[model samples]
Target: MIALIGAAVAPGIAILSYFYLRDSLEPEPISMVIRSFIFGMLLVVPIMVLQYIMQNEWNWRDGIVAEVFQSAVVEEFFKWMVIYFTVYKHLEFDEPYDGIVYAVAVSLGFATLENLFYLIINGTNIAIWRAFLPVSSHALFAVWMGYYLGRAKFSKDAKHERLFLWMSITLPIGLHALYNLIFLAVQNWLVVIVPFMLILWWQGLKKVQRAHDFGSKNLSSRPQ
Candidate 1:
């Protein structure tokens, strides 16, 4: 049981640590990072409730649209909410990279708790699979959002800021929906999934490096 819990948690923590390290400038307050994480953990309830209603009551669970919306749109939206309310306007959010730092912290929190529940019910037999697929995928999706989020924060122009913010939310939803769709379309076709994850990892790593390289001043690298 201890091992199972550890196995469930390792991926999120490891990824969180990696992102934390990428904060090249001053790090944000640990308390705030932790606060972001706890808030994210708490969001699981509302997200689950919303998804449950959509799946059970609304009967959207029968189609691929449901799979995409419920998994990608719903989860990402709540995570975005957690950020917008909790850390978005906080004074500590002073730099571009801070977005990724806080974003990953909250995301790992969500991923860690989500993983615990899944591993608890399904047992550790699938632990490896969960880590590679769900846990890591959550981190990547957060990166997708965080990259744009970071840009939006330091964006000088109001229109650029709004565009970046919009991309932060929408891009992740699209990537996440694609991730879910790949799994939904073909069971046990990890071959297809592995390449997709690899491509995402390449893109995400660049984002990570960009965040790492961000100077004390905000760089104006808007994505096209």
Candidate 2:
């Protein structure tokens, strides 16, 4: 049991560490990051309750509707809500990269608990794939979410702010839906999912770099 829990949690911690370290110029307050994570963990119950209601009330347990609306939309929406409300306007969110930092913290928090639950119920045989797939995917989704959100936060134009904020939710929903769709529709999901993940990772890294660069510039431009 301990081994399974460790296996489930290790990937999320490692991924969070990687993103947390990427904020080269100024890191987010550790307290804020932790608070975001706890908010994320707390999100699971509400999300589960909502999803359960949807699955039962609307009969959305399977098919495209289930993958898109039930799973992807519901999960990403809640994660976005937590980030937006909790730390989006906070003083410590001065750096653009701070968006990624907080988003990843929240996402990995949810992912870690979800992974633990899956491993415990389903046994350890799927632990390896769970790490590679769900855990890593959640981190990547958060990258895109944070990328646009960082832009939103720092932008001067209200239009840009609204646009970026909208993208912060819609983009992740699209990516996440496609990910779940692959699992549902593909016959040999492994082949398709690997390439999909590689693409997401490449794009996610680019967003991380751009946000990091923006943060450095934002810092330098400030009267110090």
List the RMSD of every prediction in angstroms: 3.6, 1.0
Report, for every candidate in turn, its global Cα lDDT versus the true structure.
0.85, 0.91
The local distance difference test score of model 1 is 0.85
Mind giving the per-residue lDDT tens digits that candidate 1 earns over 100-120? 888888888998999999999
lDDT value for model 2: 0.91
Q: Which ten residues in a row have the lowest lDDT in candidate 1?
A: 215-224
Question: Pick by lDDT: which candidate is best?
Answer: 2
Q: Tens-digit lDDT track for model 2 on 1-224? A: 78988998899989998998888888777787878878888888889899889999878866888899988999999999989988899899898888899999999999989988898899989988999999999999999999999999999899999999999999999999999999899999999999999999999999999998988888888998
- How many clashing residue pairs are found in candidate 2? 0
List candidate 1 stretches off by more than 4 Å. Answer: 216-224
Score candidate 1 by TM-score against the native: 0.93
**Candidate 2 versus the native: TM-score?**
0.97
In model 2, residue pairs whose N, Cα or C atoms come closer than 3 Å (at least 3 residues apart or on different chains), thus clashing, are: none
